[model samples]
Target: MKPLYRGLASATRRKASRFALETRLDAMTTRLKDVGEFGLIERIRRLLPGAPDVDVIVGIGDDVAVLETGGGSYLLATCDCQVEGVHFLWDTTTPFELGRKAAAVNLSDIAAMGGAPRWALVSLMAPQEILVESIEELYRGLGGALAEAGAVVVGGNTAKSSEGLIVDITLLGRVAPEHLLTRSGARPGDVAAVTGTLGDARAGLELWLRPESGVPEEEARTVKRRYTSPQARLLEGQCLGRCGAVHAMLDVSDGLLSDLRHMCEASGVGVELEVERVPVSPALPAVAAALKADALAWALTGGEDYELLFAVSEKDFPRVADQLLQETGTTCRAIGRFVDRDQGLRLILEDGRRSSFDAYAGGWDHFKAT
Candidate 1:
């Protein structure tokens, strides 16, 4: 870790430039982009802290970091990135909100795996002109959310970005080998349950992005909070792990239907979602009514809700829900049940009609060209 700091000068050496660089023939120079993706990753690996001696198996260089406790559990680690204009619009979202959201989203992934988060590493790519005060405030906001989620910030990196603010959060969590939930474990007859209401964040996004609309200040503030600082159901996820009831799990970062379909496809099962069973946010309906948008559609297809969805055995459903309430004060409701692979993914409407729903596309894919 001491040697890692030696490369800090490389990050801070360059001054902001108005024109592209075209240096003298023999001068040593390298554009940040010219560092190349692999080289930049090597630099980041060099900068990260070494894993503690007691529990780490692999760290800093894999697609996902790993740590073994030798207690029949292994820690699985991963991170997520939120970029301004791409993941969000800074003008529409407050720095405090953005910070909380960036951290919350990563924690949500950990929760989706039925794991309890233990550590976090945040990296911010700040623009040259943003105020130092704003940056400090953002950390305060993120710190609050991380505390609430039962995780700690162990390390971070800061650098300048010419585009917009960038927040990348890495999370480390521990899960018992027998209790770890993954998309590939679902089986026919397993029941699907979600921890909370959905679509509020997506509806909130619409409200925050459009200011000319006549929404009340208090309502606006609430929606903005949801869009900016949504919480991850980490406690509930831990309860699910303790209950030993979950088979497959995933966070609803993308649309609910899309992510659910992902779990089913991964596990080689099909799902039948009861539309009436999908929890609706109390605030979403009113906001959607004002905007002439369909609340149900928003709840079904909206992303960034950060809720946990998991499949459980029908026999363990009652015990699981009761444990969740006792531990998290959040109800875990069954929304559907898994079916045979050949049956395929389908949705049951409130009117008692059923239809097949296939994906045209789902979630944010950064590599796609506009």
Candidate 2:
């Protein structure tokens, strides 16, 4: 207890030092009412500057920052948002974790597009109760995730709000024009593939929401870690992009079924998802069984896995899977295939039962919150 208290005290002092000179005048008093939205944004913009060496035609001051890049490369852009209650629980999630989530979610979108994330703009809206130190920690998390994805946080807006916190990230990247992959590229007979396992993050979220499920300490911590820190499949996506096998790609932000439906709809095709072929994280079954939850449903509907879901030509499936495993150490497997448009999106159960799956929960809609 003594050592823990000492460490916490030291952390508090360090946090204070980190913001020694950046105090807002109304911070200690009633909420910063005088600092208008634009004033707060200007303060944040002043603190965050653009990266050196990047060609900047238009930076931060306009409606959208435009960039001049060498021709022959395709432009890839993705936007994602994280909200307090919907995406995270304030009591369980750290500021640093929140920041990483903000960035990684957007980077996952870039990965889904089969591009390398080059830059990001992070816009944050939070209640006045959030401390300056926490905000800095959030940026640190964002920086760490950006570094991992080979992206830079160029600029963004930050302002106080009485409502719940929100972090919106827009990521921009480039890939060889020929290498660009979108959800609209899947075709009949194309093989469906996924990077890494699914359901781990969903299991983690369940553990987080209900801690009394009798999970062992180590297992519980692992689940909690997955919920807090999900890695974007940037390297895997890049490798797949270079492999010339990927056709259509998307991040599994919603459950596998939902995201797959998205790709199918966009591509003007239908898909047959094999239940047995879907890879479940090793921890998923045990955790779900203990909680009396359906593991398959969890994997099918779980969000925040951040894994890449892609389609490839049938002839390229084996080679693509081999290269992806060798290059990124992430497992890639064919889960299904694109079928005729009339077949629609169908899920084949283990018992050989088939049914159409229509998921109501789209990818993180704020207005649909319970």
Candidate 3:
């Protein structure tokens, strides 16, 4: 009887110890919202085993992971995911538009690396109640967008989700070794330029959210088109790479200021942005006025523009800009210049006053709690 009691007591103690350990783990486990998307990515990167191979030219940090194929060219791979409620509203955009956007976003990353998109794989998550016709329309849009970029849908997967829809696309591209642009090549005095205008998409989103915002019909349509169907600057990026002038390049999917900061950080440099030099579509100002918001603010912090943001040597900027404009018929503007790291990121006002760029910290963080 004594031995039996001792055995039971020991078993109880083991159960208690296990429960305490689990409790402690629950307490120590950090929520993803607290860490944010970038922080979570950093943590995951730290957890990943180190790869010392030279074939992995760029990994984890940049827009795309560049791999040396030893075939005189480098391969670029990138992927992007879009959530239904988070990235778009069902009422605001159709399934077709969402599919196109998912593909375009991934292609934009490939373009940012000065590569031409060749193939894509799309994975989708949807509810069982989702209409089959809607899914077909979505595929049609995806097919069209890929065809435009000369990319094909090679393979993908589908799963039923309990919640909102999810579309993820992985794109593969190629770039010449000499023309492989990255975010680490910018230097002090390099001119920062962007292809096409900014803020139109943000303004369009605002209008979509606030239909009664009194935006003109024509202007609203134009801005909404910009949002629903963003054109990736694929040709422009290839031209920039071939021109031998672009130092570093990235796409403006994360807002101009945020993406520019990414370039500066990777290059260990800073930036001085001329606020007035930032380009905006003709429709953005009216939309801003109707919403009583700053047009420049949208241009600075709004994401999903998908334009090319690149740095070029000051001497080569004019020739590069001219050539790009001539070749693509896209408006290219030099909105800023790189500075030394100690100088810090800044924004120059119209009155010739410079201020620390504290007004806008970042664009979109996926793990942020609303």
Highest-TM-score candidate: 3
Clashes of 1: 0
Q: State the C-alpha lDDT per candidate.
A: 0.79, 0.78, 0.89
Model 3 per-residue lDDT at 272 = 99
Cα-based TM-score, every candidate: 0.79, 0.78, 0.92
lDDT of each residue in 239-265, candidate 1, tens digit only: 786777688778887788878877887
Residue 137, candidate 3: how far off, in angstroms? 0.7
* Alpha-carbon RMSD to native, per candidate: 7.2, 11.6, 7.4
Off by over 4 Å in 2: 1-70, 359-370
Q: Model 2, 226-271: lDDT tens per residue?
A: 7788888888888887888788888887778878877887788999
Model 1 misplaced regions, further than 4 Å: 1-72, 215-221, 359-364
